[model samples]
Target: MTPTTAPLLPPQKPFDPRTATIAIVTFNRSGLLSKLLDSVLEMEPRPGHVLVVDNASTDDTTEVVEGYRERFGDELVYRRMETNTGGAGGFSEGMRLAYELGSEWIWLMDDDVEVIPDGLARMGRWGERFASVQGRRYDFDGSEFYWQYRLSIPLGIPIPFAPAGFDDSGYREMNSGCFEGMFIHRSVVERIGLPDPRFFIYWDDSVYGWLASRLTRSVIVNEFVLKRTREIKQWDMGTRHLNASSDRYRYYIMRNRGIMQQYFRAHGAYRPALFAVGTAATFAKEIIRLTAVERTVRGTSHLFRGWRDGLKIARDRSFQTMPPLV
Candidate 1:
């Protein structure tokens, strides 16, 4: 069966950058966060306000933000969390504040990426036509980030698009998107609510993007907008790119599959056999990578534990409402 498509948003007034708020979530990456803020400040038509959620960084993040405040004045709004809430929780708080601040559009991103000078303006043009839109991301070396692909629910894997999948003339519908350079409108947030902070990390953006797709038209605009500065070389398995993630990341990634499963099952889109096969395939890949590349089977236990625990995680029915940040 074909995937559900987002309906085109009704025509509205012309795009205005001043009505947008850029929401950035950062954790202990003060240097990179400074670069990202510099780029955002250089936008041709800068956003009306920039809301930053510092995820309890034990670094000079506060000092870095203070420098920006002196330069940008009241255009910047900074909130520092008392604990590390991870990416999921940080974004939830930032988006919540942006909505409460009366922003018409909220552009969400991480602190490790630098926005292209004209990227926000171009995205605003598409925002006039679509309720939710995402711009393309490129690597520091200027290559397009190849892994930004739509997820195939049946296979539980990302489906890479051919060159033709990108259309310069218009937006392409998608069911999933990353937080990096994702532009969400106020109406979509009102309809679907804030992203579930329970995820605390992996797959949170995927689930939130999926919710947006179901509620309204979400698309990926065919324009390069943000550049990923960090370079992570994944294990080059012949058929797949196996990430050599840390023990903590491994747990979250494996465990988050259960959350995705719960969401799919409730939506009547679950394919049990296919998901099981997919899960097995992932396990095999990680095992092979650990033995070959890492030269040890050290953290395989976490993988098993995460998978088992994840399956028991229930779906949060009230995920639409934002939770208070500690």
Candidate 2:
């Protein structure tokens, strides 16, 4: 009997910062976005281009960006959306633009973060070990931000960050991603097409990262590269940190589980009963946090609304349009 196996792909060439394009997505955070743009200029070997996707900010976001026009000169490309697309849609739009520009490396981030001076250099030193590379971030108080993850597909969770995941390599495999500081090679984008914009906001990065993991090497390196600028009240949960939730967050967190389940099924990881249990636990946790931590039930209606819509979303056929694993 003869056996056949697919051939292994060769290693990609080392990463080059000059071939990179910085894609920043912002809503109305003009003050924070300006600082991020300032940091971009501070990069010793900055990316060749910077693309800012504005989700139709009513604030002086356009003016803030224009203030840096002379400094950025032709290096900056600003495209303002007609409407707000949330984080999910904005990132998708920004990524699509970067890809179409024929960029070799696309670094995705939000307006709330500023890359540490020389951050790209430290991370770039990794030299392309993984196609999708994530840099760590420091919280508003200069504390370590809890961002690393080992996603549980059926359980629908990003397990709390653990130091052991990094081992001796100073990097760890991750099946989830954060738009705050994700540096993805063009090949990963080419393989996955674009992030599912239907997500609109939540769980979008995880789904995109999951696909990247399935197709190639995806990792979060130990280097501290970003500083989160937005300050928020957070509850310390031993190793991980949870930010106070808003009604918008509550609704999206609940409703997006169904969208999450759709992609899980597309990836052959769906288990309805298990996912339902996970969803229920999530609902319980949010409710408890609402009543105890925040001491208010004002957002309860949004959670219920999102959950009701989520159940309906789980059964929708729109998921079929998502690309299959390569």
Candidate 3:
């Protein structure tokens, strides 16, 4: 609970949704995207704007979003990237565009999550208090989704298990973040820069949130602001859970460590020997999960490959530290 010691700014103001822009990054899953749009349409007070960043989906995603154009008008914007840049890239584009639109706050999400009627308004409650914030979410089964509030960047792990019931403050300080429902102020973006697209997928949000925590008081509130529209097969691990993953997912899960290593080293949090041990331990944990939970190492080779590639990435001298937007 005492992990993040960043100074809380004084004289915070209440957040207003009308001054915030919602950015959803989508790659296929038009059905889920449509439902999310419908949910966004019903959000109270309404957002300043909704921008859908299409990651060159081959499906009818364009048509699905186009259907809502008449009702949304200029309030809705759609930008299709020429190439599929993955979740990390799409979010980077979304945040940059949303900032260009001059919105005071930028809310980032994946298309798979449906917005709650009062989601943005709920986040707005903490707008004046903190520049960066995340809200709670529910799985499609209507169960509370488990998200880590604090992360141990040096070890590349979360500091705690599930939260102890949201507590008295109604919010918990967070160093880890979920892109599914991250609400952040433009000033924070200006101070820390946008989410790095190089991650391509995994650990991107965690690093971004941790960096934000370094600059301001970033928290995850008690409010259920988003509901995951898709269901993931997961194994119950005590109060926490591990989502079943695919080969692609597994590759990124480990391979992205390369990108994370560079960032952590740049921030002075990476210790060579400690990071190596932590990474080896991470590999072992995944192997144990595959053997005990899934009972199969079907794509285990990819994990090894990703680990090798990630090491290569970590040592690339061309890698540069993330730059600030200002």
Candidate 4:
């Protein structure tokens, strides 16, 4: 068993009915977006509010949302961005809106998902005692565990498949699976703000959760509530090069991680040197592990670019900025 520490939750305060609002960012995915909305609307206790930020999708995502508005009434609020602000930008807007609307918590997710009913019910039960916690669940299968091929560890570790809370307080760093659905408390957001918009894609979720963990406690519940499209999973590990899309993600992952380590160091909380080394090695593994077919066909270059970009970003920015996700 992992030695666990209890999270220092914010001072006990009166529970507000509208404690949390669900926020999802959508871009060019109409079909998946509809399913995600359906799952949340089906929640028993239901979200206090549901907000969607349309990132200038060309598709009729707005039409789908209009249908939901008629059915959901005031329970759902939709915002359309004139330009595509990417995932980080959309998340920032959604979270900021949640705070302004008096949400005690914000449940964040991408549009390509479907929440299991029981998973949400369990999260509510955990929220009673904890300020902010992420419910653990399979990517698609609720009964089975979700697995991922990783570089840090030789064999891929299962995404926390357990019964209830499994003492995650000791886990200083954790990944939010596929960045689908995770419950975050308002207090954590009030302290950490939203994800860094500079990280348009990758590492934004990790950066947000890292800061939140510093402010309050976070946990991964053992209940599944999301499914990734076939293409989405492939895109996650698609490249390691620095380009308009892929390279930017690599840059942020490397640079933001350095920023995280430095933040801890400044607080007199120096982590193991292996922590940084291991991270870089894992990224390298991600680059090399690609099959021959993938290399020739897909042109996977994010790993090499990540190393180069990590150095550049680290050299440029030493500490994370306040009012940013840090």
TM-scores of the candidates are: 0.88, 0.93, 0.94, 0.75
Please, what are the lDDT tens digits per residue for candidate 3 over residues 1-326? 12255453523666656678999999989999998999988888789899999999999999999999998888998999999988999999999999999989899999999988988877887777777888888888888877877876668866656464777889887887778889888877887888999888888888888888887888888899899989877787765777777777678878988888988888888988777877887788678768766779778898899999999999998998679998
Q: What's the lDDT for residue 305 in model 4?
A: 56
The number of clashing residue pairs in model 4 is: 16
For candidate 2, which ten residues in a row score worst on lDDT? 1-10
Candidate 2's residue-wise lDDT over 163-263, tens digit each? 63466889887788888888887767776778777778878898888777776667889899999999987677756766678898899888999888887
Per-model root-mean-square deviation over C-alphas: 3.7, 3.2, 2.4, 6.2
Ranking 1 against 3 by lDDT, winner: 3
The clash count for each model shown is 0, 0, 1, 16
- What shift in Å separates residue 39 of candidate 3 from its native position after superposition? 0.5
Off by over 4 Å in 1: 1-11, 161-165, 168-170, 235-243, 288-296, 314-326
Q: Better model by TM-score, 1 or 4?
A: 1
lDDT score at residue 295, model 3, on the 0-100 scale = 76
Q: Model 2 segments beyond 4 Å from truth?
A: 1-11, 323-326
CA lDDT of each prediction against the hidden true structure: 0.79, 0.81, 0.84, 0.60
| Model 1, CA-based lDDT | 0.79
Q: Candidate 4: RMSD over Cα atoms? A: 6.2
lDDT of 4 by residue, 25-143 (tens): 99999998998888777766677788998999999999999998877889788999999888888998888888888887778888877777655556666676666666544433223
Indicate the residue-level lDDT of 84 in model 3: 90
lDDT of 4: 0.60
217 Cα displacement, candidate 3 (Å): 0.8
lDDT for model 2 comes to 0.81
What TM-score does candidate 1 reach?
Answer: 0.88
